[model samples]
Target: MENRRFDIRKSLLRALFASLCGVSANAMATEQYPCKPAPDEGRFAWGRIQSIDPNYLVKRILGPYTFKIPYGYMIGRPTPERLNCYPKQNRLEFAFWMPDFRAPKKDMWSEPNYRVHEPGRDAPGPQEYVVDVVGLEFIETKAGKSGSPGRRFVNGLALLRKDFRIEETYGLIHVVPGQNTPLSDDYVSLSNEGYEILLECSRPESRDSNPSCKAYLYFTDLQLEAVMQFPADALPEWQKIKDGVRILVERWIVKEKPT
Candidate 1:
């Protein structure tokens, strides 16, 4: 009877140890990704790496996405009243979509699940606007891997398609040169001048090899989708800001185990 009691105690101790180990692993994973700050020389755009509590961020928010901007630009806390200030200067801001409170199953999906939006109508069709209303057409990139068939999202959808001149590509991310350009697409009439670049992760349904990514992509190990924009007709020299843009984002590398 003594030997039996000893065996049961050992089993309980083993279970407790396993639970602690799991928690420790998660903390270690969060610690592994550190914030990297880029230097500001007053010539080109300036950006700094910052951190936020994972719990305070959106349900899926994994890390920080800094807004890279020029020397004299003013920064403001995001609000409906502050919308006018963005166009006053070469502005950079972060956007967060409200969770779908109406439908529980569609909570993680950024867009309203039951509603369908199109260019002229409010209906889901062949090119149904399944994604958010702002930039529905561009969410699913045509450049996804062969078998994966996943899509990528560019933040500030209206700015990307109309205002910013998408100049180059750093891997899958679109690099927007800071040049001010005329509105080419008639779809978006709001912004007349700006610059922007986008970094997007593969959507869950895309069959990508990365298991950590999903639709409501805040759970990914890295900063999956982000956009930096500026109010300008002509972009300043690129040599100063390009490195800052790349370095600020590189800090968020995909982890093997997401927290």
Candidate 2:
């Protein structure tokens, strides 16, 4: 009986040790990602409207899309035209489509014969609009791999993990308007000049291999959340203050020192 009891105790201790080790592994994986200031020299154009003609605000967000980069994660951005199809290669696209809220101009997608333009120019379909993304924050959620074809939610990033290995990252992005451009699409005539933009990033559903996915994507994070900041004031004339606030945003990237 004593020997049996000793064997049981040993098994229990072994289980406890195994559990502790699993927990430690998860913690270390989380710690691998760190946040730092983004490079301030990247360029961004608003809806592709002739590059903002050298406005102060346009100059600021043009900087690199630097918010935070996890050690093993990838990243990408969307062009003005690709915003419609939600480009699969370069950027993850999320849409915060509010039913009651109206767009500044017509929906280019709704247009009978829409034509997308190249980068460095706005879509010829609607009035020009600028979005001032003051700050960006990312949140990661671990979704176990069960081949369940999990349900996706807007404004959330998905971290695909199996046996603690982060296999995939999906992100949702949100963008708020900062300036207005001339009307080219009908959706632009809505009540306001601004709208919230949400973008989702993940593996292309049609891709066949990991290399194919990487060729088209910026990076991979099991899940990522982009927290875009706007100004406290809701002034109708966001464009007027865009230059000033944009410059301020450049200084607001995340910075955390490794311990």
Q: Which candidate leads the pack in lDDT?
A: 1
**Residue-level error in angstroms, candidate 2, position 202:** 23
Candidate 1, pairs of clashing residues = 60-218, 90-231, 150-206, 178-235, 180-233
Residues 126-153, candidate 1, lDDT per residue (tens digit)? 3221122111011222355111112222
Model 1 worst lDDT run, 10 consecutive residues? 185-194
True-vs-predicted CA distance for residue 245, candidate 2, Å: 43
- Candidate with top TM-score is 1
Query: lDDT of model 1 at residue 239?
Result: 19
Off by over 4 Å in 2: 34-259
How many backbone clashes can be found in candidate 2? 49
What is the model-wide C-alpha lDDT for candidate 1? 0.28
When summed lDDT is taken over every stretch of 10 residues in candidate 2, the lowest stretch is 210-219
TM-score of each: 0.23, 0.19
How far off is residue 152 in model 2, in Å? 18
